[model samples]
Target: MSVLPLVFTSGWASGINAYAVVLLLGVFGATGLSDDVPEVLQRPDVLIAAAVLFLCEAVADKIPYVDSVWDSVHTVIRPIAGAVVAALLAGQSGSLPELAAGAVGGTTALMSHFVKAGTRMAVNTSPEPFSNIAVSTAEDLGVAAIIIFALFHPVAAAVIAGTLLALGLAAVVFLAQRIRRFWRRRAQRRAERRPTGPGVRHPVPTDGSEHF
Candidate 1:
């Protein structure tokens, strides 16, 4: 169950499958399944599941406030996965097509990261767990939708890929400011919590002259 979610979140042909499998094995060594096979090869169901999961993740990232945290976490993961998957898919296309795919893939990754990060940052202002959960779920759904549409209609996917990139960037600028504000407030609070130097320096008063 948990493995499925992890794989789905990782994305199709993203190389994450290989890394994730190995990581799982290193941690759960030979417990039930070997960790070398590609996710798609190992489980056809994973393809569909990935599509569904991505769709949800994507939608979740688009949510108003909670999208911020989701974005922060995905920042490192989405683009690389997008590029790898695009590279893999490009193999099936012509040179020109492949280049286009790669571009789309890389862009998709960048866009996804921005949108997720920005939205989450904005959401940080509220930091409501319920809102966060809702946004997270929506992004997962969005990822799935992207996968499905991209698989069925590459051209449409390309267009959407561009749109997503734009939107993600927009979100970055929008949420960055908000996140900064949140951080500033948090820092101020921390500073306030700190103890001021020595608690009331003892009056060296009478003994001051002798100490000197």
Candidate 2:
């Protein structure tokens, strides 16, 4: 079976939740359900570490501004994790070149990361915490479902991931454009409200003699 699909799927998931992808892949490898997963990822220590981090993320991701801060910190971590996982999967399966896999994985992860981060920032605008919790829960469940399904049907999973990624990027662009327009209008209003510049003369009342 070709590993490219799994690579792309995992890369997309990793952008949202790296630890969950690692933990799920580790379990799949340890259970002997998938032979494409790297041996190192299946080790007991690695699994344990992934589990702990996953739990941490699961909690932090539910908070409003905290989630945004967490996203900021993981900006670098997610793409790296995606690249490493893709390289390992390719190297183990020998179905794709390691460098090529890494490049694809890293680029995909970075794009998806922007989607997740931008969405979170937008969601953070809501004063209620429920929205944040709901969004975070959905993301976690999404990652789990995609990774699990990828193991059984990689091609379909990749197609789904790619479509979702495209939609997400579109949403981000729309939001950004809206925000830019808002700020531009606000600046224009401020400029209009300003007092007239120096040297501009006001109408003078004439009483016998008006000063020129």
- Steric collisions counted per model: 36, 0
In model 1, what lDDT does residue 10 have?
Answer: 27
lDDT of each: 0.48, 0.90
Local distance difference test, candidate 1: 0.48
lDDT of 1 by residue, 1-212 (tens): 11221222223323212223222222222233433223333343544454465555455545554354444555666666555545444443323354555565555456555555556666667745666667666554455465444434545654664566566677768678777876787689777887667674544667457563
Task: Flag regions of model 1 displaced more than 4 Å.
Answer: 1-74, 94-104, 189-212
lDDT of 2 by residue, 1-212 (tens): 78999999999999999999999999999999987789999999999999999999999999876887798899999999999999999999998999999988888898999899888877766669998899999999999999999989999999999999999999988788544553465478677987797997666776757766
| TM-score of model 2 vs. true structure | 0.83
Q: Root-mean-square deviation of each candidate, in angstroms?
A: 11.2, 9.0
